[model samples]
Target: MCRWLAYSGTPIRLDELLYQPRFSLIDQSMHSRYGVETTNGDGVGVGWYPADSPAEPALFRGVGPAWNDANLREIARSTTSPLFLAHIRASTGTAVQQTNCHPFRHESWLWVHNGSIREFAKLRRDLLLAVDPALFPTIEGSTDSEVMFHLALTFGLRDRPVAAVERMAGLIEAVARTHGVPAPLQMTIGTTDGDRVWGFRYSSEGHSRSLYYSTETAALQRLYPDNPQLHRLSEETRLVVSEPLGELPGAWQPVPESSYGVIQKGADELGHFEPAAP
Candidate 1:
């Protein structure tokens, strides 16, 4: 339903990923080849760690569509960071408002997603009630994405990311099933604590939303030996996106349907994930 990308590596110009690629995130906002929709123009957000400070990331988000937002374009060109999160939204039953956009922040963490709750309204009340009281007041949006964020926080995401996320999925699925919502909750979530990045792709059913991660740096270097831009990157630089930004046939690999991946300083680690209760 949406498009997003998480990058961890050497500090590079934002334009390097959002504008320079053959099928950049900006380009995808106007022309997406594999997302549920061809256009994701409801809103956009970018979160990055400033070079001078790695623990806290600065986030800029707006209600306007990405392609038409000059401010977004300008920032993409001017800002640079080693770890960043970017999202282009295609609202699913939510208003096209700035708060509804993603890369939602809490202290040193940032998160984004590319899917929706099967019947969010039916379970919103119950889900909201389950959030940690301290974090509940901080949730400023109505999208399932934000709800999911709060859920993770409630489960202690800041302390145990993997387990918290697993609990989040479990809670979401349980509520959905109790309300009679069918299986297959399409979800592809990316989260970062300004250091390590975690990307998840899963559904209640076997098939989930499309998600891909770049090949290991050394492998990519071998494949694109003649490309200086690629060679300049360290053996650890890596990318995880909802869809491949370019048609680099061998550059991207699909994340297993029921799996989650972790990236730290450009290195990737992957594992299987169980569906939420539903």
Candidate 2:
């Protein structure tokens, strides 16, 4: 339903990942090779950790198309961070507005998702009521993606990300079953607390959206050998995206279906996951 990328490791300018690649996020906004829609012009958002407070992530989002957002270009040139999350949106039954755009923030964490809930209107009320009342005020958007964020928070995402996500999927399934909606929910979620970034790819029917992670920095350096741009990155750098950002063959590997991946400095791990029971 959308395209997104999460990056963690050595500090790098936003442009390095958003604009420089042949199939960059911005390029994907205009022409996606592996998404339901090629043009994700509904909105865009970026979240990053400042040099001073790595624990506090800042976000910039808008309802305008990314290709036409001048502010995005300016920020991409001027800002640099060790961890970042960006998304280009294609609306899935919600109003296209700033607050509805993603990379939703709460304290030290930021999150975004790339799919939709089946029959959202039928279950919105129940799902909303299930959220922690304390978190209700922070819920500014009306998208199922943001609702999914708060559900994870209710299940304790800040302290136990993996389990929190599992709980969230369970809640979604429960709501879907309550309404007897047969269509499956598809979710490819990315989240970061400024230190460790996590991405999950799953669906209720067992067929989820696309996701890919970059080859290990050491391996890429050896493969590229003479490419100065890639060589500039520290061995700890890594990126996970909804699709390959460029034509660099072998530079990206598809994340396995029904799995979640964690990315930290020099640490990249993938684990098989099961949908939370309804």
lDDT tens digits by residue: candidate 1, 4-121: 9999988898989998998999899999999889999999999999989999899999898888999988998999899999999999998989899989999999999998888888
Error (Å) of candidate 1 at residue 108 is 0.3
Model 2 spans with C-alpha error above 4 angstroms: none
What does candidate 2's lDDT look like per residue over 1-278, in tens digits?
Answer: 79999998778999888898888999999999999999999999999999888877889998999999999999999999989999999998899999999889999989999999998988899999999999989999899999999999999998999989998898888878878887558999999888899999998888888999989988999998999988888888888999998878779999999899998755578998676774
Question: lDDT of each model, Cα atoms only?
Answer: 0.89, 0.90
lDDT, residue 26, model 1: 87
Estimate the overall C-alpha local distance difference test score of candidate 1: 0.89
Best by lDDT: 2
Error of 2 at 115 (Å): 0.5
- Point out where model 1 deviates above 4 Å: 265-267, 276-278
Listed in order, each prediction's TM-score against the native is: 0.97, 0.97
TM-score of 2: 0.97
